[model samples]
Target: MKNRIRDLRTAKGMTQEDLAEIIGVSRQTINAIEKEKFDPSLPTAFKMAQLFELPIEQIFLFEI
Candidate 1:
């Protein structure tokens, strides 16, 4: 999976820790997700979408 999480977070002036707290996740989890080393769960993804004010598809790219 590819995501624009890092870009969005930085654009919003949010540190990983800040975003993590808002999304109820650990900083490491946010880091992992931003690095594309881990994929977020559905609920987590939804939270991100809501926070970023974007659709999940806009934040995350699914490749077949």
Candidate 2:
């Protein structure tokens, strides 16, 4: 899986910490997601989509 979290967050002028707070996750979790080392749960994905006003598919891309 790959994600546009880092790009989106930065484009929104939010730091990892800021995004984490809004999404109700740890900053490290946000970092991990941005690094593609972690995949967020459905709820978390939904939160991100809501925050960004985009579809989950737009943020996270599944190659397989």
Candidate 3:
């Protein structure tokens, strides 16, 4: 999957740690997600969507 995590974070002026704290994950987890090295669980995805006020599809996309 690919994501707009980094762009969104920058747009919101939020650090990885800041997002992690709001979503109850570790900064490394946020980093991994931004790098597309990790995929969040459903609830985590929902929380992230809620935080960004975007639909999940806007943030995450299937590569193929």
Candidate 4:
């Protein structure tokens, strides 16, 4: 999964820890997501989309 999490977070003036706290995840999880090392769960993805005010597709780009 290629995501715009870091870009969005920074654009919103949020740090990874701040975003994790807001979305009920860990900072490490946010880091992993930003690094594209792990894919988030459906619920987590929903939380991120809601927090970022973007559609899931906009946050996480699926490449085939």
What TM-score number comes out for model 3?
Answer: 0.95
How would you order the candidates by TM-score, starting with the best?
Answer: 1, 2, 4, 3
Regions more than 4 Å wrong, model 1: none
Best by lDDT: 1
Question: Model 4: residues >4 Å from true position, as ranges?
Answer: none
Model 2: weakest 10-residue lDDT segment is 30-39
Write out the backbone clash pairs for model 2: none
lDDT of candidate 2 over 1-64, digit per residue (tens):
8999999999999999999999999999999999999999999999999999999999999998
Candidate 3 clash figure, as a count: 0
Model 3 C-alpha lDDT per residue in residues 1-64, reported as the tens digit of each score: 8999999988999999899999999999999999999999999999989989999999999787
> Which sections of candidate 3 miss by over 4 Å?
none
> Stretches of candidate 2 above 4 Å error?
none
- How high is the CA lDDT of each candidate model? 0.98, 0.96, 0.93, 0.96
- For model 1 the TM-score comes to 0.98
Residue lDDT tens for model 4, 3-60: 9999999999999989999999899999999999999999999999999899999999
